[model samples]
Target: MNETSNNTVIDERSDILETLAKHRHFLRFTTRDLTDEQAGQRTTASELCLGGLIKHVTSTERNWADFIQRGPAAMGDFKNMTEADFAKRADDFRMLPGDTLAGVLAAYEEVAAATDKLVADLPDLNASHPLPEAPWFEPGARWSARRVLLHIIAETAQHSGHADIIRESLDGAKSMG
Candidate 1:
């Protein structure tokens, strides 16, 4: 994908964008022919639904992209989060009222576009940001924009697999043979 920024065509990010798009496609493919109720239904004991997985991936990508641009502040203080914060975070994996599969997919597409645009326009992927204070991260650790992109790719790919399982359980459909 060649993106024009300030009258300059940027293609350096095409590989990354294409890779991400492929994963996103697989995730969305699992929802084909699914109704809103089916998308929201928990197929397995894991409490994961197709729409919820898409929602979670969308939120994660947006947050990570923000982290790439605004540093750790974008994620807020995870270490200081309250129980309510944790509860709210869990909402990402739920298909809340009024959420439709179409809406969830649309949001994911929007986030994907924004992230791709950021990758294309970003001045330096090597620019680093100190990670937020979270249990999963090592203290004093930092990540470059490129690292953040990889993290996003990993998260999307991982969740795509989860979605595939959920979809298969919901129906006989399979994302892959």
Candidate 2:
């Protein structure tokens, strides 16, 4: 690539990574000073809780990043899971037995580090893979690495909003204030 192109690549990766870091900061900030039980409390009518949202975002981003590295099938075989199996996957959001806020936060940091590295190391953001089949996803779709990063950002920001509401409801504490 030419010098200008190289600079643009660097700038794009830096921009995405910085935005992800900013969102992550706010997400973690919302969970501060919470016991495991408190983190799992559902403060709103929705099933979402602060701890659950944390786990969900971690898993989601990790899976997408892995997809960027290893392709869509890296997400695993979900074609024939039993209803009970599906139920357990659904519980991935909750702070289940043996789960803690600290553990989840630590895992998030690890995933973020690995994902940022992958983003920087990729030759081009245009790298893509066929998306895994899912009920919500359109059939035969492909997602570029750039799209994956954007999705992660969107997911993180969306859950951050949910977490903000849950956190404020839990103890009347604002996430930023």
Candidate 3:
């Protein structure tokens, strides 16, 4: 069934997809009329920029979707990450050399398409995988695909708000009134 089917009853997957799409729209809207340099410009005390926010969100969504399919292996062992590893990961929050706003948005769209297909095709949302070994996650915890979807939605929504702030600070444009 369509994610936005007119039927009275909507499935959990459709709801998840719809919520995700809405947040994605808000996030992308924040980039409207921005040049590559503008998109990469840090608008506030925080290090976040519009293009970087999109880049981070795209990577995050792709990883979580992989986790839903391939278990904790999808997330590399964080316990042994070197300082350089962390520094490299931190690059996701910046628009590096040759990075363009259009390119970043294109990558996000690609990831989003793949994630949507995975959600629609997954055999069971109840299927779960162990949490990766990370300080932020509970030890020995597992997450259902449903939980991952919720997490993705939350992540997208939170970043969308951040993007709005960055966009407004960059100039006076607001994603929403």
Candidate 4:
């Protein structure tokens, strides 16, 4: 019987993949029915905007997925990044004049699909990679694929909260349905 046909036999990916999908749904929900400009609006003192958060999470997930395949070297000299490189990375979170809610949302969905497929294909979540050198991270830390997946979930959850507050402040729209 096909995996889909055998509903009684729970799939290995159900826990991590399903939970992440639910959170991604909530994050995408926060942006619904908003114009491009509205999506880019910052109603609070914090710099976060809904569209920007979408962009940030999309980029963050894609990069981390690449790291899973390519390891710490894929992170590429984080310790030596200049102010301009840092500035450029920071700008990814904001919706520039040309950025649209639809575009960011589309990119996010693409990342989601790719990650779900990756999880399904992996033979061992225990596969490990050395973390890049960063002051924000502990020295010589290594993360297994399972740990990386969990970290992705954590990042999404935190950003979802930020998006919710920003959405509410923008137009009194609550995300918890």
Model 2 misplaced regions, further than 4 Å: 2-5
What is the Å distance of residue 63 in model 4 from its true position? 1.1
Write down the TM-score of every candidate.
0.92, 0.93, 0.94, 0.92
Q: Using TM-score, rank the candidates from best to worst.
A: 3, 2, 1, 4
Each prediction's number of clashing residue pairs = 0, 1, 0, 0
lDDT of 3 by residue, 85-143 (tens): 99989999999999999999999999999999998888777789999889999998999
Best candidate, TM-score? 3
Stretches of candidate 1 off by over 4 Å are 1-12
State how far residue 59 of model 4 sits from its true place (Å).
0.9
Query: Regarding TM-score, does 1 or 2 come out ahead?
Result: 2
Task: Give lDDT tens digits, candidate 2, residues 67-134.
Answer: 99889678776666689978877887798889999999999999999999988888879989998877
Error of 3 at 100 (Å): 0.5
Worst 10 residues of 4 by lDDT: 3-12
> Taking the tens digit of each residue's C-alpha lDDT, what string does model 1 give over 1-177?
223453332454676788899999999999999999999999788988898899999999999999999999999998789999999888899899999999999999999999989997888777899999999999999999888998999999999999999988988899999
Highest-lDDT candidate = 3
- What do the candidate models score in CA lDDT, each in turn? 0.89, 0.89, 0.91, 0.88
- Badly placed stretches (over 4 Å) of model 4 are 1-12
Candidate 1 worst ten-residue window by lDDT: 1-10
